[model samples]
Target: MITLSGNTIYLRALEPEDLDFIYTIENNESVWEVSNTQTPYSRFLIRQYLKNAHQDIYEAKQLRLAICQQETGETIGLIDIFDFDPKNNRAGVGLVIGSQSHRNKGIGSEALALVIQYSFQQLQLHQLYANIGSDNEISLQLFTKFGFQKIGIKKDWNRVNNVYKDELLYQLIQ
Candidate 1:
């Protein structure tokens, strides 16, 4: 398992014990916009997914890591490397802090730094990208703080509450 630790938080591979946390976050309608969740997930389905959570990222083509507090070992958020393309040495990054209380803290920043370091150094990736909704200023700021430049925009990319929203593509090239 890969564990990347920081001063306040650490990123670790998913475990069977995280089923409830994953299920709750996946089904949270308030966050569905960013997560692209269409419907609630059943516990059975989540259990099945957790059973295979240990698969290698090379085989799974994506990796979802839990962001936990270093002191309490409580999961506060998740960071994912999706749409992995090893041949191109690039992947899309997705992150969520799970609740409003967790937002605006330094947790996401620390986790992002750890993930970027792991992606570039351990995974040997050349670049990493993030797709953030135009209205999500906090996330845009977070990625930009790490030198992820705004590469392009997908006009009216995501639909939320029956309205279309633009999605910005930010990239960090190593």
Candidate 2:
């Protein structure tokens, strides 16, 4: 699915124009916990990544989309379907809004709904999963709202600021 639309937002394929946006997000330390990123990335790497964004999910085993506002067409975030296993009909889903000001406004909800539809319907996937930090109430609620159940929790899974935290595995089966 090249583009998946919701009422207020849409998911579009990553484009060369998104190089700066992707670089900013990749270097944003605030989102490192959710993205499992330990260090910042340079623009050269991001540009090279964008160059390979055209690979299909089956070929690349992942799909990253830019989340754009419907009204203004300004990209606000990104969503990903990674570890795609066509033989198993399952994949991992994750998303992040670039700014705090753009969060908690139902933008993520809309973006996720569209991806879920695309994953399950167009992609013909049987299930999707997300790894969320235990302390992340917002993400927990959002996934649960879409029927993703918490299957397990890994204790001391992630270290943030030298403190270990639990990571919850949530799954949505079709």
Candidate 3:
């Protein structure tokens, strides 16, 4: 995977050494709520996730990258292109800005732009889509700022905090 940099953010392939950071971030309830990942994250789980990412990359099923601060090298988030259909030239995108301190700092937007550039320029993907929970207004707005159009909403598609929530599907075509 290509390491992309801009402003104060940089993205690189998710490494095994990043498990600790991933564990800390994903374990936070605030972070997990927006992500809809209810299971408590641990170092062991992160290792497994990284292993799966490695396998997926080799098999061309998906690509995962870690978003870090350029100067400090602290892992702040993760971005991924999943459900890739090479024949159709399309993929699903996922992102999580793990650090609450980093929220609203524009880092997520920059990292997202970098990932889109990589998807279109390097992976040659023609379309990228995001499935976001209706309650995740921040992410919805974030993707919207990047030109992703709201295609439709999936009724009661997700269960969060013991309640069913709709998922809004958005897409950006290159």
Best by TM-score: 2
Residue 94: error of model 3 in Å?
1.6
Compared with the true structure, model 1 gives a TM-score of 0.97
Cα-based TM-score, every candidate: 0.97, 0.97, 0.89
Displacement of the residue 91 alpha carbon in candidate 1, Å: 0.5
Which stretches of model 3 miss by more than 4 angstroms?
1-3, 56-60
The digit string of per-residue lDDT tens for model 1 on 1-174 reads 344899988998899899989998999998898888889999999999888888888988899999998899999999999988999999999899988887888999999999999999999999999999999998999999999999999999999999999999999999
- Expressed as tens digits, the lDDT of each residue in 62-94 for candidate 3 is 887889898999888888888889889999998
lDDT against the true structure, each candidate: 0.92, 0.94, 0.84
lDDT over C-alpha atoms for residue 59 of model 1 = 88
Is candidate 1 or 3 superior in TM-score? 1
Model 2 per-residue lDDT at 36:
98
Candidates in descending lDDT order: 2, 1, 3
User: Candidate 2's residue-wise lDDT over 14-106, tens digit each?
Assistant: 999999899889999989999999999999999999899999899999999999998999999999999999999999999999999999999
